[model samples]
Target: MPMRLTKLLGIELPITQAPMAGVQGHALTVAVSNAGGLGSLPCAMLSADALRNELTAISRQ
Candidate 1:
């Protein structure tokens, strides 16, 4: 069978932690990516400059 979402993501389940900037961190983003499901982030709350920083940091990881 095709890999389920979690297996495809290298995680135990096909779930993601929210990308809550106030609470979530880079570790959470990479973790979800590594685990397979998409991670959530609140880009709307970020200013353009802040978004740039967040994107840059995630890209580096």
Candidate 2:
């Protein structure tokens, strides 16, 4: 069956990587995005520069 969340999110799959404050990093987020899932990156505890770098990395992935 097709997942509505996938359609809504415009992803191939409905999977969403949790935004684990310390655990979710750029690599894991990019990997999940590469696999056609929603990759969530937590920015609450990140420095502005770090978040920018992570965003830049994820955008390239």
Candidate 3:
């Protein structure tokens, strides 16, 4: 059967990494995204500038 999550998220794998604030960043998110899984950026503990920078970094990958 087709995975609902994969179809909904447009990813090959139906895996989602939990957003771990203060423990993870864009690198981990990019890695998961590259591997065809849903990756989350933990924004709760980040400042606006930090979030923007992380977003920029993720986009660059």
Candidate 4:
């Protein structure tokens, strides 16, 4: 396949998993990243502390 945004993001594919807060699971991001797609996480709606925690979790994985 041709290069796409996913490749720009350092992934192997051009498909990204849509992130939905309170709906889609955070694990979805890791899964999509593993699959070469850009994994996304919805944290814009979270508070500063919550966002920090979420980022820490991501960093750990």
In lDDT terms, which candidate is top?
3
Query: What is the lDDT for 39 in model 4?
Result: 85
- Give per-residue CA lDDT, model 3, range 1-61, as digits (tens): 4588789889999888999999999999999999999999999899999999999999999
Q: Rank the candidates by TM-score, best first.
A: 3, 2, 4, 1
Per residue, candidate 4 scores C-alpha lDDT tens digits across 1-61 of 5485655678787787888998765578877887888889898788888878777877778
Clashes of 1: 3
Provide the TM-score for each candidate, comma-separated.
0.59, 0.85, 0.92, 0.77
Colliding pairs, model 4:
none
Where does candidate 1 stray beyond 4 Å? 1-13
Instruction: List candidate 3 segments past 4 Å from native.
Output: none
The 10 consecutive residues of candidate 2 with the worst lDDT sum are 1-10
Residues 1-61 of candidate 2 have per-residue lDDT tens digits of: 3577788898998788998998778999888888999889999999999999999988887
**Tens digit of per-residue lDDT, candidate 1, span 1-61:** 2357656766565676765757665667876776766776667778888888877888898
Candidate lDDT (C-alpha), each? 0.70, 0.89, 0.94, 0.78
Model 4, residue 30: distance off in Å is 1.3
Best by TM-score: 3
Descending-lDDT candidate ranking = 3, 2, 4, 1
Error of 4 at 42 (Å): 0.5
Better of 3 and 4 by TM-score: 3
